[model samples]
Target: MKVMKVAIIDYNMGNLHSVGRAVKHVAPGGTQVEITADPDFIRHADRIVFPGQGAARDCMRELETRGLSEIVREVAKTKPFLGICMGMQVLMEFSEENAGVECMGVYAGKVNYFKHLNIAHLKTPQMGWNQIQQKTAHPLWTGIKDAARFYFVHSYYVEPTDQSLVSGETFYGLNYASAIAKDNVFAIQAHPEKSAEDGLRLLANFMQWQP
Candidate 1:
């Protein structure tokens, strides 16, 4: 069998070390994880992971500056693309957090900050561990139990127009789209790298997921 080569997009926004380490640990031997800024590598990668660690506009700018916008879009179309943290948010058409910046538009929606009646008591960022209520079953959640707690560090959340695209959700003053997948594009608001065992399993599942 050919080894599954995973390309972790090194767009300067990803938590590179942690994500790279986690993929190395969970994936089978011969599965190589490469951190690359090269568009060609990303375009040809068997699996692509778009991990983000900072602001939405900054990340979008970086992709545009590096001329990776269209390349990333092409990769997402054919290969299994996984987005984490701000990476996940960038999959949408726009982000309310950034005001006017456009995103990859893989998913139809806008990412917005938390706002609800019960939100006054809770924190803004919603940092630390939270239970991800699995909404729709996907290959990425195989062998993973329901209500799995994943590490999250974000203030904004995705409000997808297509409800069917949502794969999982979490409550932080309000229920938000924590995970979503439509065809080859898969994304998560939670950080699987910091999520321990279940996170590892999620990464493993992504490695084996065939688009």
Candidate 2:
């Protein structure tokens, strides 16, 4: 059996299919990527991937219903975890989306909608490709460039109270935390599966990341 087991957490609100394909693509022949909702299966994995897309209310609601919320928090702290898109947002203390949401509190911060920013000229849900300015050195960003462009599709952006934890920043209407990292957890507000070359490079890096 492959010793490197990567669990793409399935809380029923994520793009598991795409994310799994992405991970498997970069993963070596000796690595195994499993999409699972079983807590024990996830807890035992070598790496964890928390991926989500859509409203905060639904994401939190589903996680609670499936009893995966706490598991997510626990695994994030214990392993090399990667949170993508809504996965990254929910790691914060709260979110302005869906009329305020109490997040997992993994980080001290909140997610905000672009409309609430009061920048009328700027478009909400800054979709398509955007450049990420690397603010810190990380194993996941091994081969990626400094100002690498990644795929993003969200109206809400995360603002962490601890700005020092931010690994990457992106500018839309304003500069916001596109990625954050501390210890074994690395979270990003972009979808690597749809990000093409650099995105694949990130996943490739994560597969070998010792953190």
Candidate 3:
């Protein structure tokens, strides 16, 4: 039996153990989940899960310092790529964080800090569970109901120029792109690993997704 390999990119941003375990749990039998920063390993994997935390500037710097920036861009174009949190944010053209930072530019968008919330109860980071409204039907959302709640922890959110790329949206102070998909790449602002059953189902769908 052949073993499919899933690479969880490590760029010194945050711990990948939870993401690794979640992927391994949902992966079909004989699938290997490796948490690595090695370019060769990432290039050879059947799928790539890029989960990140911390500041965008720091994360991008780490990827460049380790010579993994180009590799990530290449992988996104050719393979089944899933970007979580900061991983998804960095795909944009630029970020307003750290006094403005340039990202991979894979997607034409900008990451902006949450602003102008009239509601006193809402927070900037938008932490905890939030409902995701499916903007469009896709394989990654299979078996997951519309408006499913997912875990989120970020002060900045992505605003893609092209609305068609938005696969899901969530509202806090306003409706923002919670999930974006283009070609073989699908990214979400939420943490599926931390989320419960629906999150697991999404991961399983990604494992079997062909497009």
Best by lDDT: 3
- Report, for all candidates in order, the number of backbone clashes: 0, 0, 0
> For candidate 2, what is the TM-score?
0.97
* Per-prediction TM-score to the true structure, in the order listed: 0.95, 0.97, 0.97
Candidates 1 and 3 compared by lDDT, better number: 3
Off by over 4 Å in 3: 116-121
- C-alpha root-mean-square deviation, each candidate: 1.5, 1.0, 1.2
The most accurate candidate by TM-score is 2
Per-residue lDDT over 83-188 for candidate 1, one digit per residue giving the tens place of the 0 to 100 score: 8998889888998766667888987898887743355577888899999999988999998999989999988889899999999999988888999988988899
Model 1 alpha-carbon drift over 4 Å, by segment? 115-118
Query: What does the lDDT come to for candidate 2?
Result: 0.92
Residue lDDT tens for model 3, 64-159: 999999999999999999999999999999999999999999999999888544567777778999999999899999999999999999999999
- What residue pairs clash in candidate 3, if any at all? none
Full ranking by TM-score: 2, 3, 1
At residue 150, what lDDT does model 3 achieve?
99
- Cα misplacement distance, residue 76 of candidate 1 (Å): 1.0
